[model samples]
Target chain A: MAEEVENFEPKIVAFLCNWCSYAGADLAGIGRYQYPPNVRVIRVPCSGRVDPLYILKALQNGADGVLVSGCHPGDCHYIEGNYYARRKFAVLKNLLEALGLEEGRVQFSWVSAAEGERFSQVIREVTESVKKLGPARRMVKSFEIPKEIEKEIAEA
Target chain B: MDIQSEIQKIAARLLKNKEVAMVIGYGAGSAPNRTAPVFIDKEKDVGKLVFNRFCVNNLSLYLPRLKEKGKIAIVAKPCDVRTIVCLIQEKQIERDKVHIISFACPGLLEKDGKTLFASCAECAVTLPPVYDTLSGEAKEMERNEPFTDRVADFFSKMPAERWEMFKAEMEKCIRCYACRNACPMCYCEECFVERSLPRWIGEGSEVTDTMIFHIVRAIHTAGRCGECGACARACPMDVNLAPLAKQIREDMLNLFHHQAGVDPNAPAALETFKPDDYNDFIK
Candidate 1:
């Protein structure tokens, strides 16, 4: 079990805004940039569209790490969507940190459509940080019956 | 004159003139040392209105529900008035329809009447930000301490210990949703929690679900919470919800220098953003 635990691979969920970060990831793929295979991408219309609930839901569903990326500060497809998103993200990040989650478990970054290399670099960094932290235990919901309850059921 | 008789006189005058269709104020609850919201439609019942240390309910929570009833006259503390400002800014209620009778709150007492609710103890705004009439002379009180001290202390604990504290709090939540119901800003016709087509959150008091519920609720009310302490007061389990809400308020002030309900004309912090809002956390 110890040997198996040493080989643990992290699962990461990345929420990328459709106009920029998603395009950047696509460009990374088209450019054949090598990056970690840990992240599963979900494209949203805007970074502002990613409710904090989505991040919490990903964590609650047992993802080891979550990343949210969007257009650069002044470059949102919508005039000021990323600007609004930046504020929400700051508040959410602070609240989550205060709630006691490990720092690197959730990340925020700017990845424009032109920066394919930066996208891969962020993925590499996020994967390595989450791997160092190991699997998330806090905020992960367990559906399995309690051991005592299982024992009682067996006796009954 | 005592504040209670003053409140009764004002309520009677409002009812007598038919200036308001109804006046929402506090009355004695069935239990000792408790107060309940009373909706007085008749002038005679103005005598039932009371104000004291026990009037802890943030009556603005009822504004959205009562807006359709008629033009309303509400008794508001400084904190409750903040919620009213939020409600109006959110377009949940119109500014012109309701008459606000606000007072200078001398901090609320706990059931014991000695200790103050955490929100009230550190309250800086004792006078309402907006009111149609004044109930009493605005009292001068010094705000010496930041209200987030306790929350900041909790945040300083180890990660494992903090998680334990959060889990313990979640375990005590019975999903009564009194917190959501009591919040003036949570006036959605269809809350995300109730949506079934694409159920956003699971309906359970399980630890993770409760945590999600709270986190989502806190984020939703992030810049808008008036710090009225109504949610904490309404909780039968005493769930220490102030810290979570206070954390958002602190972040708003720190990041945007914006305080909710302080300026009715300014856009909410989350709804509008500055070009150079803080983003040191972003890569």
Candidate 2:
């Protein structure tokens, strides 16, 4: 049972902006850098397009961790998309932290297209962090109806 | 003259002169110490308009609905005026088409009448920021505490405790959307909650669904919310939804040095960005 538990791999959802972070991840692949295969990447047009709902939905739908990566400040392909995204991410992070999802379950990073090695490093770190926290039990929706509510529905 | 009578006279004059199509203000509700929104088209009905601590509805919520009805005269509190400013800034309503009659509020009492509402206690403006006409004396009130005091207190709690509190708060939601309806800023024709094709959130009273509904709503109102406390007050279950909005508002001030509804001509915080905006979290 201990070995089975130790072998558990965390499922991480990564949202990478099309301009910078996605290319960075691609470069990581081209470089053949070895990293955890736990991440599932979703390429967005820009970091600004990554709405808080997307992150929340990922967690709700059973993602063990979420990583949102974008262009560095002043380097957005859209000029200021990452700037707006920065403000939004700050607020969302605060709210999520306050709601108790552990410290590193959700993360943000700036990875340029040229920084392939950095991309792999971020993924490895995120995977390890989420692995340490184990599977997310809170905020994941359980489809089962409560016995009391089931009884009420049957009676009605 | 007392503030109540002055407001009535102003509303009456505006209606009598046909200067506006209608006047939106508060009137006595069925229960004692309750006030309902009253629309007065006739000058004589202006007497129904009253001002008191119980008049807690952010009257600005009615502006967008009445936009196409022609020129309107709205009786606005300082906080309600912020909503008007936001609506005008968003172009939901034409500034020239509506006349504002604003008042200096001392503070408002909760429905119980014994204590001041949390929003009222934290109010930074006693006088309307912009108005065509004004009433009441500007009473000096001091805010010894920070605007984000309540949110900060909640943030200081352990993650488990905060999560438990959040769950407890969201559990009472019945998906009525009264909070949305009562908000002036929530004027989206196809609210995300109602979307179907790429449905953002499921329409269910389950805890996760309800939480998603609220979390999205709160995020939608991030820098745009005027902090009128209408959403929280409108919830029949008394769920405290304002803190989420307030937390964002605090962030807007701290991160961007911006406050919603303060300057009509200024661009929204999220719509504009500085290259050097705070981003230490982005590693």
- What TM-score, computed on C-alpha atoms, does each candidate reach? 0.94, 0.92
Distance from true location, Cα of B71 in model 2, Å:
1.7
Measured over the true interface residues after superposition, the C-alpha RMSD of each candidate is 1.0, 1.5
Q: Which residue pairs in candidate 2 have backbone atoms (N, alpha carbon, C) closer than 3 angstroms, thus clashing?
A: none
> After aligning candidate 1 to the native by TM-score, how far in Å is the CA of A90 from where it should be?
0.9
Candidate 2 chain A lDDT trough over 10 residues, lowest sum = A94-103
> lDDT of each model, Cα atoms only?
0.87, 0.85
Over the stretch B95-157, how does candidate 1's per-residue lDDT look in tens digits? 988899888888787787666778887678988888998877877655443233456667778
Q: Write the per-residue lDDT of candidate 2 for residues B1-283, one digit (tens) a residue.
A: 8888999999988888899999999998888778999999999898899888788788888888888889999988888898899999999999988899987876677667677777877778878889988876666555333233355566778888888878888899999999999999999999987988778777888788788888878877877888888787788998877568767878889888888898998888878888778877777
lDDT of 2 by residue, A2-63 (tens): 57447879899999999999999999999998899999999999999998989988988889
The per-residue C-alpha lDDT of model 2 at residue B22 equals 94
